[model samples]
Target: MSEDAIQAAARALSAGRLVILPTETVYGLAADAGNPEAVAAIFEAKGRPRFNPLIAHVATAAAAERLAVFDDAARALAQAFWPGPLTIVAPARADGGVCDLARAGLDSVAVRVPGHPVARAVLAAFAGPVVAPSANRSGRPSPTTFADALEETGPSAAAALDGGPCDVGVESTVVSVLDGRIALLRPGAVTRDQIEALVGPLPADQDGAGEGHRSPGRLTLHYAPEAPVRINAQGASDGEILLGFGPGVGDPRWTLSATGDLREAATNLFRLLREADREHPVGIAVSPVPMLELGEAINDRLRRAAGFVG
Candidate 1:
């Protein structure tokens, strides 16, 4: 949060070292997108597969334009949602300078202009594209606070910026605008309705695993905890930690939202999972979250956390 800290992180990044920077969604393990070795360190630190592409965080729309060819829909979405949690995937410009490793050697790149001031400041200070994925080991819950990030991957990073907890508490909604069509890649705080309002109805969700990796967050069994997770439970059995949604679950350890506000539940989702996993319970059972608005994103994360697929 300090100017000195930002400067130090900028310097480290300029020197091709990793820095854990906070975003509105989650803390990210950031490296120079143009530096292959620096970007490689992120994979090494998180144990992430090379085929999973990274999101390139930029300072402005112009910066993003420099990296990818924006179509009509992509431009409009960027104008409306840049500086927020909406990632746009577009064809990488032939001259786009992002490293091959960061893009997974694909012709497209997932890029965003984050809303978090600390993250924006770091991007501006570094003055280039930063490939930052969630700052946690692969298949683990993402860190929403500085303390959790430190516990997760701090030793591998040169420095970490403490910017408090993330406001969104989930990854950005990723939409790929390719070949004159818009496809929802991932859901987040930005609802499908919002994107549809601007770009018309979206095509079916893109299968990154089947088609190829054009964006991040496509792994089947990701964002998981050490404890087995069971979703849509009416109640938790003995020895299991209950994560309730609409309350009335009889003194649950963590309630996503006692009032049943999906937004509030989304904000608390990852932090609660991290907390519950720390207890080393027999298992974690969660109440059903409505399949609407932010709930879609919350459930997406929960499903992945439970390792239901892949």
Candidate 2:
């Protein structure tokens, strides 16, 4: 942490003020999790719905234990993904001591230990839980940089942690362990296959599709760009195209990139989206990416960007 960042975070948490902090996924609008007023300020700042809830960020597993009661499964997942992009929903341990508003009236609360040094620094300095989520308006793209946070949450949001660019550039994978079996509430940096390998086969949702109270990212029409987007097949002709995992044989207006490499595509996805959004074409078209390790998350974002379809 920079000296300025530590000072700013300390001051803000001390004063019960909200601060925008960086994480492995994206910057988050952070406030004292123990302070209801400060946590309320975060909702006001981000225009986030009280129904959506916020994730409490702690510096260490010991720190997280204070916020929620973890079972053995929860503990294992925490051990595997702490200091990384994964949030587990477990029963809150406060017994009404901590603010229930941060948990959205739910018995369980979402919590994680972010992989960013600045985030850890702030948590370490405050020596308390910080409730935060992506530092953007409720349904907008999550900001991966301090500049983007400033744009979304305004300049006076205290300090913006300069932790360079985010590695994942998306929200954390969320799993709910309050129930008997491990259930994936959201797909993110941690894939479903990875989870299955660790545990047994994931409990199948009998509803056949994940939605409503079941899964988080199952919401249609999410992670959308400001403009319309389209998806095209490989080597297929599309108007004003942006190839996701291959070369473009058409006009220069169509941006071209590789389809096989998920990491390269993930790194460039948002930047390309921003560029295409600025170009303001009738519609932005993306070619299909190959299905692989990180490809699931990449394709999920792409599907959302392209209005949840091909």
Candidate 3:
């Protein structure tokens, strides 16, 4: 991407306007984290619930430390996973620049140091924290390509930066470390094994409708496609569009990973869903994916897309 595009986007955020930004995970509708009006624009544009909160993206982990108070575990995870698909949720500093709306009126904040070159360039140029939620309309499939992003909510943005297709097709893995304990809030490109290896065992996160304010990806019916979805599907039901895993699992055009690679499957998940939804099929069916490694993150998105998450 050109420096001009990045600078234009940076300027828009500085002016409390919206910008559509590319990240390693997916396209995001970004705003200045310190600007409540800009942050409110994101909710209005995406039709996202105010209580869902948003993640503050920074250029570096050191920059992130200025806003969120990270304990030992949070710091270790940040060191190991920053510049990649991992978000650390922790206690907010008294002077953290993130606005109350971005934190959903909570005392905690979710922050990520994205790995995408274009996103990093914009963050560095902006020289401040910005909150970026998925660019698509709330509860819709996330946009993996610039075209899809523009189609979803581009009109609401003052500027946009295209970084081609996202390397990690899913959002960041989110973990919260508070009061000397750790819990997994959301699963994404970062696998559990990778985090557990660095931070030891993690406990299950306890949350309900009232607690949705603590995280963005906790809702059960998020990431939905236009058509209904059936998981562990043996084959496409009559008129159903099939998305299968592994070689020869189903039509090659709809396959997640022809070689059975979980990483490839994760990268293709959202794109396939978007493609299938366009065909106006009776429904979407997905073959059973093993709950291993990146599979957990893949299944997490699938379950949410199918409205089975809780």
Better of 1 and 2 by lDDT: 1
RMSD of 2: 3.2
Q: Write the per-residue lDDT of candidate 1 for residues 1-310, one digit (tens) a residue.
A: 7888999999999999999999999999999999999998999999999999999999999999999999888999999998999999999987777899999989999899999999999999999999989999999988899999999899999989999989999999998888887888888998888999998987655553344368688688899989999999898888899999885754545988888988888888889988999899999999999888888788889888888642
Q: If scored against the real structure, what TM-score would every candidate get?
A: 0.97, 0.86, 0.97
Return whichever of 1 and 2 wins on TM-score.
1
TM-score of 3: 0.97
Candidate 2 regions exceeding 4 Å error are 96-98, 204-219, 232-243, 247-259, 306-310
Tens-digit lDDT track of model 2 for 1-310: 6677687777887698878888888788888887888888887886666776778889998878888888888888888888898888777885624577787777777888988888898888888888877777766667776677788885647766777777787778777776566777666777777877776676554121332242234435555567776665544334354545655433444443443556666656665666666666656667766656667676777776666532
- lDDT (Cα, 0-100) at 251 in candidate 1: 56
In the range 70-152, model 3's lDDT, one tens digit per residue, is 88888889888888999988899989999999999899999999999999999999999999999999999899999999999
**Pairs that clash in candidate 3:** none
In model 3, where do residues sit more than 4 Å from their true spots? Answer: 204-213
For model 3, the local distance difference test gives 0.89
